[model samples]
Target: MQESLRALLELQKTDQDLHELEQYKVDIPNQLETMETVQSEAETRLSDQESKVEDIEKNRRQHERDLQAAQEQVKKYQGQLYSVKTNKEYDALQAEIQAQKNRISELEDGILQLIDEAETEQETLETIRGETESLIERFGEERTTLESRLSAVDEDVAVKMDERKRMAMRVENQVLKVYDRIRRNLRGMTVVPIKKGACSGCFHVIPLQVVMQIRQGRRLVSCESCGRILITEEGLEY
Candidate 1:
């Protein structure tokens, strides 16, 4: 029975280590996933900025074409000025020429505004591109290390699991089942050493008779209040 208690105590320690390793495996992958998400978002922002620049360029080019057409109409109106006989006809041709010139002026102003907007958009696009590149570079080594750690965790867990199985085999079948049941119920230690004559798990005071039996280490004793298997602190020694 004392041998079984020692086996269970050792098994619980390995189980604790395995549990922590499993949690580490989960946490490291989440870190990797978060890094990937950040990089993807930066790239998406860069793409949207580039599209804004392209749209601005298209509008600017269209305004330039309209400005060219307006200038040509002004030339045609001035040529008609030489053929007009009446003053009214000449005045009308002059008014038409002025209207075409006004249109050209408006088009030029619109083109200038579009060009300024395009320049601003281009600057923003470049900024986003740089930010995206920096994020990739800054996180590159960290991402690689996290990936490597994830793979290493698999190997570590495998070795720990094998160790746990071997330790479990040393305990009696019924004792092992009770230990597993208590662990399932508590999600923590199944066997604990008595501390200050009380169950360390629930801090229940031990009866004198149970304390004596636990000291003998002749068989497993349980805390009356907590159902945790009890051992003297000395019993934990190899």
Candidate 2:
């Protein structure tokens, strides 16, 4: 019983190692997926910024054309003022010239504002581009490293699974069935050593008689409270 219990412990250790390696395999791909999401978002932001810059420049150019047309209108209105036939006609011409000048002033202000907006948008676009490029480069390096680690984890998991099987074969069939059943029911250690005169699995106190029985290593002993197979650490020492 003691030898079977020792073999079961070794099998459990191998199974735990295999479980960790499998989880690691999952975690690496999850990390890579996260990185891909980040890269996609960065690229989206950069593309949006570029569109903003392009729209701002397009609007700026349109404002410039409007400014030029307003200037030409002012010149044509001023020319009509000198050819006025009467005071009323001259007053009307003067008003027309003033209206065109005011429109020209407004167009000039709008063009200047558009220029400022275009400059700011262009700067933002460049910044986003730089950041996106750097992120892609960094993700590329990390992806390579993660892929390598994923392969290594696969190999380690395969080896640990084989080790678990070999160790499992050493345990008695009845004992192995009980251990596997307990492990399936619980997501933790199925076999535990006696600690401080208690079951380490659930901290349940053991009677002195049971402790003596466990120390003598004669028959299989189980903790009544947690239903865990109990062994003496000294008897199971590797």
Candidate 3:
């Protein structure tokens, strides 16, 4: 019984190591994707801000062109005033000049407003761009560090897996089968030692007879309350 109990304990250790490795394998890819998604979002936000800034700049230039054209029209009207021979023609020219002046004023006001808006937009975009760039840099560095640590952990897992494989070979097939069954039912922990007259796995008060049997390390025994395989105190680390 003691031999079987010892074998079961060893098997559980190997199984736990295997479970950890499998879990790590599943988690690493998810972590990498999460990091990449954050970086992508940051870039997209920056691109949107840049696009808005560009639109503002283009509109500002168009307004400037319109203002210039208005000024040219005023100049042409002034030149025409000197050539006007009739009062009616002179009045028409003056009215046209006045209309042009009003139009120029409107355009100038629009241009000024656009310039102010563009300045504000440019400043906002710069701030957003700077923040995005800083976050990108910080995330990149953190991701690189995380990747390095994950790589090291992966290597360690592989080493531990190899050790588990070696340990599994030492235990009997029957013991491994029972350990696997218990592990499936109880998640990863299949074997737990009796601690202070209680089952370590479930913390249930173990019967004296069961505890005595477990201490004897004779045939494998299970917790009557939780059905988890029970081990003796010596089964676990001292």
Candidate 4:
């Protein structure tokens, strides 16, 4: 039983190393994705603003063309007034010319308003583009540094994993199971030393009888309060 308990300690150490390595693998990729998301969001916002500004400018140009056509119609009617024969004919031409002039005035007003809106939209587009570019540059440098650190962590995890596998092979199945159970229950800490006659694994004080049994090292003993396999601080070499 004592040998089995010792094997449990060894198994716990191996599993702990494996757990850390697994977490490291997950962390590196999550960090990379977060950086990518930030860059993508900035770019998307910049593009949307640019598209809106372009639409505004296009509408402004169309409005200007409509105003020009109205003005040209007014001019054509005015030029025909000189060729009129009777007073009634002249009056009809003059009325047509006045209607065209009013329509031109309304179109011109609309064009001016569209131009003003386009200019404001263009300024907003430029601001967003500048902000997006700045973020891309800053994020590029930060991502490089983070990726370098992640690579180093991955290499370290690989080396530790090799050592953990060797240790795992030395322990028996039942002992490994108990070690893993304790690790899961205790938040990844399965092996802990006894200190001052108390179980360091759970901080429970060991009775005198159980303490003596642990010291003899003939059979495995557990903490009365915590159910963890107990080991003495003295008498045996780790």
Choose the strongest candidate by lDDT.
1
Best to worst by TM-score, what's the order? 2, 3, 1, 4
**lDDT (Cα, tens digit) per residue for candidate 3, span 164-187:** 777777766776777767777776
Off by over 4 Å in 4: 1-18, 86-89, 165-177, 184-187, 192-238
Better by lDDT, candidate 3 or 2: 2
Which candidate number maximizes TM-score? 2
Model 2 stretches with alpha carbons more than 4 Å out? 233-238
- lDDT, candidates in the order shown: 0.87, 0.86, 0.78, 0.76
lDDT of 4 by residue, 117-136 (tens): 88888888899889889989
- Clash counts for the predictions, in order: 0, 0, 4, 0
Give candidate 3 misplaced runs (Cα > 4 Å). 3-7, 85-88, 149-154, 194-205, 232-238
Clashing pairs in 2: none
TM-score for candidate 4, residues paired by index: 0.71
How high a TM-score does candidate 1 get?
Answer: 0.79
Which stretch of 10 consecutive residues in model 2 shows the poorest summed lDDT?
229-238
| Model 2 vs truth, CA RMSD | 2.3
Candidate 4, residue 83: Cα displacement in angstroms equals 1.9
> Quick one: ranking by lDDT, best first?
1, 2, 3, 4
Instruction: After the best TM-score superposition of candidate 2, give how far the Cα of residue 107 lies from its true spot, in angstroms.
Output: 2.6
Clashing pairs in 1: none
Pitting candidate 3 against candidate 4, the one with the higher lDDT is: 3
